[model samples]
Target: MRPLIVFSDLTLDGYMTGPGDDLGFMVDDPALEAESTGELRNVADAIVVGRKVFPEMSAYWTSAEGDLAHWMNTAPKHLLTTDPSVDTSAWGNTVLEVGDGIERVRELKAKQGGALVVFGGTATVRSLIAADLVDQYWLKINPVLTGAGGSPFTALAGQRRLTLESARAYSSGTVLLVYTS
Candidate 1:
């Protein structure tokens, strides 16, 4: 089984997004995205995202052009959703409906493949964390604080210790923290 990496952005206050789901604090640097996510593209064959994140991800990435966008658009994706009525016709990702939880991820991990990555969905990340399914976490921590916002780690039933693999600081003031569980 290949590694399952959670590649995400978080504010200094540990918020994934600010109030009202404002992502204004996220870095707008194309080079940064290329540098980070682009690296994962080589090893990450598939993406797993929650239903709540797919619409926004699809709408933006389908029209965006770049190496990162190409990976985002072409990756075979598993959209975790209990809703059977969702229109899975999005062109960005080759979308397959999946049960809304971590069981499918568990099964996927047992197979031979490249890494399965969680790019944007916090709920998906949190669920995987709860299930102890995530093998590695690559968090890009931005140097700003959102006093109130969404935390992917919140509401976790218990603690899971992680080993810090590496920490690198980028010129954009975003620090990349990689961990292995």
Candidate 2:
């Protein structure tokens, strides 16, 4: 099966995003960005996102320039959504998937691919983690702390033990932690 990797940016306090989905605390970190891009480029050729995150990502990456944006724009994006009104045509190279999100992801894993990387909003991450579909976790821990915000680990179905694969500290005060189930 093609692996499902969860890619997330986290605050030191473990919040994925501040209240109202604020990402203003996040800073530009070249060192961490380079390392993360290198890792993702090697492992994934496709991207998966939930309904809430799809529009945000598509708008940002479509006209953006850079290696990451290039990958984001070119890679086939699988969007899991139950809303029948969503038009996939406006978002280039997008595939809209209906029904159970986990099941859809499992089907994707069975197909020919390098890896399916999941970039998520809070609810999607919670579901993915709860379903135990994630094989690897790439978390970038930034120095700033968002004391109150949404957490990917919130309201988990059960406990999941992860083995730490590697940890690297970047000059920008960001730490890249890799863990596997």
Candidate 3:
């Protein structure tokens, strides 16, 4: 099975976003998005995201230009959702994945693909982490502290240990913390 990498931006307090999915806490650096997500594009051929945030991500990337945009639009997106009313055909290259998410991800990992990168909707991230399915975690930790917000590792079913792979700090006061299970 190919490696599964999960990337997320977190505050010093371990919050992924402010209340209501607000990401206004992070410092604005266009290069950050390109530099960070750009790397994922190089190693990953497909993206798995939750249905909740799929539309928002798709809309933002559809009108984007450049390498990141190309990768985001071209990579086949698999949306995990139980909603039967969702029309996957509305998107260019999307598939609705129902049933066991962990099982589905395992099946995808078994395929002959490069890597499967997961984008978020809080619940999905937490679920994957809880299931111990994530192979690698790429967390960009900002210097700021958000007293209250959304976290990607909330309510984990069991404790999972990780080994520190690397840690690098960027000029934006953001530190990239890489960990592997």
Candidate 4:
């Protein structure tokens, strides 16, 4: 079974983005970037994302004409969405899973492959966490504070315990915290 991982950058106030989906408040540390890129490479065969996040992310990563962009553009991706009519031609090796998001994720995790990474869907992350399907969490704690904005983590019915597997500080003042549940 592959491990399910959730990755996110959060502000001091616990927000993932500022007003109108402004993510500029998140600090970018060079060392952190290097560490994240290295970790991302370990992710195997597939990337999972929610419907709402797919189009934008797919467009950005696929259209980017650089080394990193080329690599991500070619990776296999699975999108869980209520809307089944999404055109995936732009995203190579992309598939749409039309069913309960959590169930779909479970099915994916059961498959023989590398780590399955969930990038930016807050709702999907909450669902995965509640279902106890996520094995690892890579959270980048940014230095700035966004007074009010989007939250990376949604409210849960109960508390979920996690152990800090590793922690590293970057020269750019960003910290990467890896946790296992």
Candidate 5:
């Protein structure tokens, strides 16, 4: 089965984004961007995201032409959402799975493909982790500290353990931590 991977950036305090979706506290280092984006492309044959992330990310990346853009546009995408009203016809190679996120993801992983990369969607990530469906995690630890913000693991019902797979430091002081369950 293809591995389910979670890629996210968090502050020193483990907040994914500041309160009210304030993303100003997030740092963007060139080196980190290149490395993270490259890794994301390499590992995943398709990206599985929440409905909320699909419109924003698809609009931006599908129109921009680059390695990441090319990968995103051509690669298959699965959006997990319960809303049947969402129209995804404009997005090429995109599928809408309106059911339990974890079960839908598991079905996707069973298909023949590379890893399924998941970005944002903390709720979905937490569900996958709790179900032991995620195989890898790529967390970019930012330097700033957010007193209040979205957490990396919020909806998780219980404690879970992971093994460190690799770590890298960026020029801007952001650290990329890779883990496996």
Candidate 6:
């Protein structure tokens, strides 16, 4: 089975976004991004995202330029959404999967592929984590601290012990922590 990985950017306080979904707290270190994203794109051939994240992610990446956007535009996307209203025409090479998100991801993992990577789906990632389907977590912890906000780790049921695979400190004060459960 192909490995499934969750990719998320979190603050030192473990928040994904600040108030009003303000992402200004996120520090954009080009060098850090190139190093981290480049490595993942090399091995990941597909991207998985939840319905809620698909619209925003699709809109941004579709018109954006850069190696990451290029890869995102070309890579096969598996959108797990039961909402029939979602239109998948904006992005090419996308498969609109309707049904249980977890089950669909499980099915995708069973198929022949490189690695399935999840980008910006908090709830989706939480479900996968709860199901114990996520193989690894690629978390980028920024230096800034958001006093309060939304966290993917919020309300997570049970306990998940992760083994630290590697730790890398970037010049931008951002740290890349890789963990496998």
CA lDDT, every model vs. true structure: 0.82, 0.86, 0.82, 0.80, 0.81, 0.86
Error of 3 at 115 (Å): 0.9
Against the true structure, candidate 1 reaches a TM-score of 0.92
Q: What digit string (tens of lDDT, one per residue) describes model 5 on residues 87-164?
A: 887678888898888789889989998899888656666677778888998888999987998776776787878999
Model 3: worst 10 consecutive residues (lDDT sum): 28-37
Top model by TM-score, which number?
2
lDDT of 6: 0.86
Runs in model 4 lying further than 4 Å from the true structure? 65-68
- In candidate 1, list every pair of residues with a backbone clash: none
Q: Locate the minimum summed-lDDT window of 10 residues in model 4.
A: 62-71
Off by over 4 Å in 3: none
Summarize candidate 4's per-residue lDDT along 21-137 as a digit string, tens digits. Answer: 787887756567655766677775578888877888887887666444655777788999878888988888999998899889889988898898888666677778778888998
Q: Give the TM-score of candidate 3.
A: 0.89
Return the TM-score for candidate 6, rounded to 2 decimals: 0.93
Q: lDDT tens digits, residues 8-117, model 3? A: 87889998788788888877556676787777877888889988888778787888787767787888988888786787664578887887777888888899988898
Error of 5 at 119 (Å): 0.3
Sort the predicted structures by lDDT, highest score first.
2, 6, 3, 1, 5, 4
Instruction: Candidate 1: list runs displaced more than 4 Å.
Output: none
lDDT of 5: 0.81
Candidate 5 residue pairs in clash (backbone atoms < 3 Å):
none
- For each candidate, how many residue pairs have backbone atoms clashing (under 3 Å)? 0, 0, 0, 0, 0, 0
lDDT of 6 at 84: 66
TM-score of each: 0.92, 0.95, 0.89, 0.90, 0.89, 0.93
